[model samples]
Target: MDGYRGFLGLLVSALLVGFLSVLFTLIWVLHYREGLGWDGSALEFNWHPVLVVTGLVFIQGIAIIVYRLPWTWKCSKLLMKCIHAGLNAVAAILAVISLVAVFDFHNARSIPNMYSLHSWIGLTVVILYILQLLLGFFAFLVPLAPLSLRAFLMPLHIYSGLLIFGIVIASALTGVTEKLFFALTKPAYSTFPPEGVFTNTLGLLILVFGALIFWIVTRPQWKRPKEPNSVLLQPNGGTPEGVEGSMAINFGKADSESNNEAAARKRNLPLDEAGQRSTL
Candidate 1:
């Protein structure tokens, strides 16, 4: 299980690292295009599609944290069960929202109001998501916490949350800035270029930092003293016995009345009977 989990963690970490790298490269490309004074044709206002997809990603990020919390805290089984149910409920709602966005986008349906709504709501969600992540971290220190919960999910939660934050913040900033620019200047993509480069670079830096943190937290240390083993049974008729006493008691004759009677009968036998008994 540990090996499987380690593989999963490495896979996720690699994917996130790759994603951040791509995002950074794109951001740089966008900035370079803008610096070179290229027309906004290279930049389009099609981020709504990306936003819808990424919003679902954000939801996944939140779900990971929420699902992990109870396990990390070693909460009561009932509480953990309840939390699982609640998280599932929230995930269902988000899933519906994501589906609606997908269909809406496909049908060429534009909700100008929804654009603002999704933006603000997403920003709020990201903030809470970050807070939940912070709390999820505390779960690691508690030994009673489930290993799968911490070892497998925690790093993903951290990395995913950071990535989501970067993406959402960039999306929000670019969105608001573009809107303002359009309101003031004009509806030309030339006025403001996509800031993907800066956002991506920021995300990469965050991923690196997160990796460093994970290493620091999970590094091995000297072993702790084990609990003293409890004595489950005793020798010498239930009395406490040290090692030597326990050995002696096992090797000695029975201390019961039956053994004493048998000894007395042997001693009382006549010499001839004793000799015959001994020969027998």
Candidate 2:
């Protein structure tokens, strides 16, 4: 779309890298290591990397940028907020499951847990991610927070989302490196064995994917434009009716109550002009 230059190409590249990262993870586990299982074998351990890469890394990246997609601008803001919260909830579930897989595998083999920097940072990221999800859901999506408070938290929300994403990528890189060191001693990772090369490539793809996501999200020109007459601004929608009233009450201070109601009833509002003001 004409909304932002370079966004389309960058988004396509990010998707390609994200899919490759997941596929390469699967190949590494199935072809090079034991296939997935849940009996507390090394197979069970395979689920950790796959779930983390797929759900935490790839899906979370998508969730972070969903609002920036120009095509989805026509949808209700409340709908987009729900989609965002749902995706993050899914990512949180997968992260917790992956942690369970790791702890279960460790306990079965009598291997110590929470002993590595990766584990420590990973746990912290997951906890913070859940907290962010809950707070954002309550603040913006639920309309409990005033417009001023939502506006105040918006910057922090964006910053924390990106920060959590970067930390997850770093933890994944360390996890894969740790795996290589422990699993490839037979051929010695320095020998450049096939698995070593393959896993290294996977790590690189993940890193590139993370970098692309950061670049796409941080670009000011790529931000989703504000929609003044959105469902979040209307009073007749089903679930969003409450959200609309909250917006009218909190953000409509520049005009009198009657004027706010008059403006809200006008369905002929132009997008270009409406895009100037931000409600959420």
Highest lDDT, which number? Answer: 2
Please report how far candidate 2 places residue 13 from its true position, in Å: 0.7
Error of 1 at 19 (Å): 17
Runs in model 2 lying further than 4 Å from the true structure: 1-5, 230-280
TM-score per candidate, chains pooled: 0.27, 0.82
Candidate 2, clashing residue pairs?
none
Candidate 1 local lDDT, 1-280, one digit each (tens): 2344553464466446535543543454354333222122322233332332233333333333332322234444335435533553454454445344434543453435335654566545545554543445355433244444455665775575556545544544444444434333333444443343344344444445345334322333311112233222333254332343455455554556668888888787777697898999
Q: Model 2, residue 266: displacement in angstroms?
A: 32
Clashes in model 1: which pairs?
A: 27-196, 27-197, 28-197
Candidate 2: minimum summed lDDT over ten consecutive residues — where? 233-242
Number of clashing pairs, model 2? 0
lDDT of 2 by residue, 1-280 (tens): 4545589889999999999999999999999996999999899999999999998999999999999899898888889999999999999999999999999999999999998998898899999999999999999999797665676798999889999999999999999999999999879999999999999999999999999999888888888876754344322332343346566556557468768677776754666357766542
